[model samples]
Each structure stands twice: as structure tokens, then as C-alpha cells.
Target: MNKPPRKKNPTFGIAIFIVVAVLLVIATLFYNAITEKREFDRQNAPEPTISSDAAAAAATTAKPASGAAQ
Candidate 1:
């Protein structure tokens, strides 16, 4: 039995390597960008506001009810 000669595809291998490297670089850039965005958001996040019910309760406590003595 005679086997066919093997083919050496150097270009294909190099192309694959280049494509993989490019994809890795792109993925790294995207990951870093997302991480930086999250960090920025965490740092600059707004302070939580008091709920309306809590605010109203506080207001009521601080000030006397209507017609109460001053």
C-alpha cells in the first residue's frame, strides 16, 4: 500500500497564529476597557438617597404636628 505525500502548509499555520494573536489582543483590550469602566462607575457612583417614607417620617419627627404648641 502506497500513502499520498504529506503537505506542508506553513502559510496556513502562520495565518492562524496571527489571527489568534489579534483576537487575544482585542479580547484583552475589551476586558481592560470594561474593568476600567466598572472601576470608574464604582468610584463615581451617586450617594443613595433616603426613601420618601423615611424622609417624611424624619420631617414629622423634627417638626411638631399641626396645631401643636411652638
Candidate 2:
């Protein structure tokens, strides 16, 4: 069995490497844009943000009312 002659071009490998690198950079940018858009939408969604201090104060004040009712 005779194998086909291989083409000898050292630059061919470099060309392929450059193409792959560009593709990877484009893919990364695309992925980052999509993730950022999703995050932006999530921030704009109708979810309420509560502070930890306000939550703790509410819990402490409610405890005495519940105990008095019992």
C-alpha cells in the first residue's frame, strides 16, 4: 500500500493556528455578550432588593409581638 504524498508547507500549520485562534476569540466575545445581556435582563426584572439590616430589625420587632400574642 502506497500512501499519498504529503504536502510540505510549514506555514500551513501557522495559518490553521491563526484561523483557530481568531475563531476562539470570536466565540469568547459572543458568549460574553450573551451572558452580559442575560445578566442585564435579570437586573431589570421585577425582583425586590432587601437590605440585611432592615430584615434583621423587622425580625427582632416581630418577635415580641408574636410572644405577647401567645
TM-score: which candidate is best? 1
Query: What does the lDDT come to for candidate 2?
Result: 0.88
lDDT of 1 by residue, 1-70 (tens): 9999999989999999999999999999999999999999999998767796688788778667799988
Q: Which ten residues in a row have the lowest lDDT in candidate 2?
A: 61-70
- Report the Cα lDDT for residue 64, model 2: 56
lDDT (Cα, 0-100) at 50 in candidate 1: 73
Question: What are the models' TM-scores?
Answer: 0.63, 0.54
Per-residue alpha-carbon lDDT of model 2 for 1-70, expressed as tens digits?
9999998999999999999999999999999999999999988887555686678778778355555856
Q: Give residue 4's lDDT in candidate 2 (0 to 100).
A: 100
* Segments of candidate 1 deviating more than 4 angstroms: 1-4, 50-70
Error of 1 at 62 (Å): 19
Q: Which candidate number would show the highest lDDT if scored against the true structure? A: 1
Clashing pairs in 1: none
Tell me the lDDT of model 2 at 12: 90
